[model samples]
Target: MAVLFSVIPLLLIALAVYGAVVVLRRSRQVSSAWSSGITAQARCVRSYTTTNRSGDSMVRTTLHHVYEFTTRDGRVIRFDETDGPSTRIEGDIVTVHYLPVRPELATAKVPAPGKLAASTGCALLFLTVFIAFAIFLIVVANSDSMR
Candidate 1:
């Protein structure tokens, strides 16, 4: 039972760290794309929504859009994005930025510095909270063992 408690908190900490890493990496990628990427006009080919039911009455809907753009070299690329602008429907044109060498990593808009900082702060905060919680759990487990 004690081991189970320790394991659970450790797992949570690990997950938190993983989440932080993912967030940081994505931020770096987006930053890089914004700095050294090519701009193109992408046409929305399809707009769709996916509904997920969690329980008897709980439902979650996610919006997805498929866009196709032609690169400068005449190659066409199509990609799907989630939670894009709601006003964007099929046949609408939107601006996208992507690395020439990595066209697959396209983004609809440049990430603002403020938003990037906020996201990084949030991820670090999440990691810090989880680490503290895990340490607290270990302390409690050790105290119980002394009793």
Candidate 2:
């Protein structure tokens, strides 16, 4: 029982660290792309909607947008924006930011600087909480063993 309890907290901390790393890396990639990538105008070609049933039996629909753009080199690429649907129309033009080396890795919009920083901070905060609780657990287990 003690071993299980100890392992659980460690596992949680490990998972938190892994998640934080992934988010930070992604944010870094996007930030770098924005600074070093080529910008072009992409058009919303079409969208697909999916209906899902919520936990309360309410039906909800989500829209996935598909956009296409031509790179600076005149190559065309199409990608689906998984960040949910926007209010854009089929003919609406949107700015696309893509890395020159990896054109497929692109985003229609970049998040605010504060937003990205806040995400990293939130992940680290959760990690701090997990570490604190894990330390508390270890101390209690040690005290119990001594008794």
Candidate 3:
């Protein structure tokens, strides 16, 4: 029981660190993509819906879209955009942003700088609260051992 209590706090700390790294990395990637990516027009080739059974027999349906675009160097690239505008249908043209060197990291929409900042701030705030809770758990476990 004592071991379980100590292990739980450590697990929380590990989770906090992992979450921070993931959030920071994603923020950096989006920032870089938004700042330096090349702009191109892509045409929606197909749109499809996928349904899956989530938890407790709940069904979740997701709409997926595939788009194709021509690079400046005369190369054609086809990619999937899952979180794109739901109103887009096949044959609709959309603006795409991608890095010249990493075209696979293309996005149909770049988030506004203010929105990105707010999202990162919110994620970090949650991580801070999570770490504080983990630290409180560690202190409680240690004090109990001392008594």
Error of 2 at 100 (Å): 0.7
Ranking by lDDT: 1, 3, 2
Better of 1 and 3 by TM-score: 1
Model 3, backbone clash pairs (residues 3+ apart or across chains), number: 0
For model 3, give the 10-residue run with minimal summed lDDT. Answer: 102-111
Candidate 1, position 88, lDDT: 85
lDDT of 2 by residue, 1-147 (tens): 777767877787788778778877877767776777478899988877888897887998777778899999998988876554467668778888888777776777654678767877887788778778877887787678777
Ten-residue stretch with the least lDDT total in model 2 = 80-89
Question: Which candidate number would show the highest lDDT if scored against the true structure?
Answer: 1
Q: Candidate 1, after superposition: displacement of residue 6 in Å?
A: 0.6
Writing each residue's lDDT as its tens digit, candidate 3 over 1-147 gives 667877998898899889989888767766776787578999999999889896988998888899899888988989886656789999999888777887766777655878878988999999999888988888888889888
User: What lDDT would each prediction earn against the true structure?
Assistant: 0.84, 0.77, 0.82
Q: In model 1, what are the clashing residue pairs, if there are any?
A: none
Q: TM-score per candidate, in order?
A: 0.84, 0.72, 0.78
Top TM-score: which candidate number?
A: 1
Measured by TM-score, how close is model 1 to the native structure?
0.84
Arranged by TM-score with the best first, the candidates are: 1, 3, 2
Model 1 alpha-carbon drift over 4 Å, by segment? 51-60
Given candidate 2, what's the lDDT at residue 144?
81
Runs with alpha carbons beyond 4 Å of true place in candidate 3: 46-64
